[model samples]
Target: MKAIILFGHGARDARWREPFDRLAELWRAQHADVPVELAFLEMMQPSLEEAVATLGAKGAKDITVVPVFFGQGGHLRNDFPVLLDACREKFSQITLSTTPAVGENVAVLQAIIDFGASAL
Candidate 1:
């Protein structure tokens, strides 16, 4: 089965992951057919490797990683590719793919704009 991993740059504060957790929950509710997981880049648990392992054990073959980062910054450009390569090597059986940073997406930007506008 296909699965998805929401990738984020983690913070030292545990509460920083709240939005990611909510996104995963929302994904589960909306896309029951595809499994979802939240993975972190640093200062967090369930790194990309662990998340891939979890999905692998759960019988997921194709997994797409969506970076929740605000932009294609150094972390996304440099660190993320290295991490993804490692996960691919470690989980050879799984087909790993990824999308650009969420903040760059049109829908995401619009949502942010709408939210800001709503406050006015």
Candidate 2:
């Protein structure tokens, strides 16, 4: 089976998880047949390694890691690639593909405009 892991940069504030978890649930509903997992880069449960391991254990031989983060910042440019390299070594049997960060998408620009319009 194929798995998709949504990786987020964790926050110290507990409330940060609420929205992520909700999004994960929504994704799961949309893709009922595909396995979806959530992971945090730091300050949260289910770190990247753990999530990858779980997917591996669940018979996911092919996995795609998607970053639920904004911008091509340090996490995307540096840390995330390193993490994926390590994960590749650890889960040698699994084929992993990392998607581009969400913020770079055109839809995100529209969403930001809508939010700003609503705020005013």
Candidate 3:
């Protein structure tokens, strides 16, 4: 009964969501038991609450929302808490939790560094 939400700060360009879509596909492919959804802070479909509802419908009681942003900027630091609170109030039956922005993870930073080095 656990699910994951990959939350991102959306951009206006339609193509901006391609990576998010791919991430969802990869998650589904690798972790078949846990359902995953992509959500956005703006300019995208399936807002965080909507993603939560989708997972809830799938019988997910515990949900972990991973902020896909590189850093804990304003949206992640300020806007996200408000949105998460709203979702919690609305989806009282579901347990909602979130992790720090992806960029804060050492593995991700190392991957970025490796990719940069590979380009040289």
Candidate 4:
């Protein structure tokens, strides 16, 4: 089975994970067949490797990681690759890949614009 990981940079505040939780819940509700996980880069419980391992245990052969960051900053450009490489090496059986930061997507940007317009 294929799975998805909503990857994010963790924060010290516990409440910072609320959006991530909501995203996973939304994914589960909308796409029940595709298992989903929430992984953090730091200051969190499940690291990327842990999330990938959990999915692998559940028989997910292919996993796509979507970075929830707004931009392709240093964290995404520098540190993320190292973490992803580690997960790949650890979970050789699973095919792990990542998408660009959500900020890079035109649709997402348009949605943000629409949201702002609705707010106004």
Q: Pick the candidate with the highest TM-score.
A: 3
Per-residue CA lDDT of model 4 for 6-107, tens digit only, reads: 999999999999989999999999999999999999998799999999999999999999999998989999999999999889898999988999889999
Write one digit per residue (lDDT tens) for candidate 3, span 36-102.
9999999998899999999999999999999999989899989999999999999999999999999
Order the candidate numbers by lDDT, best to worst: 3, 1, 4, 2
Task: Please list all clashing residue pairs in model 1, or write none if there are none.
Answer: none
Clashes of each: 0, 0, 0, 0
Question: What is the lDDT, from 0 to 100, of the residue 7 in candidate 3?
Answer: 98
Compute the lDDT for candidate 3: 0.96
User: Candidate 2 residues 1-120, lDDT tens each?
Assistant: 999998999999999899789988998889988898999999998988899999999999999988999888998899988988999999999999988888878898789999999999
Provide TM-scores for the models.
0.98, 0.94, 0.98, 0.96
Better of 2 and 3 by TM-score: 3
Off by over 4 Å in 3: none
Q: List the lowest-lDDT window of 10 residues for candidate 4.
A: 88-97
For each candidate in turn, give its C-alpha RMSD to the true structure in angstroms.
Answer: 0.6, 1.0, 0.5, 0.9
In candidate 4, which residue pairs get closer than 3 Å at backbone N, Cα or C atoms, i.e. clash?
Answer: none
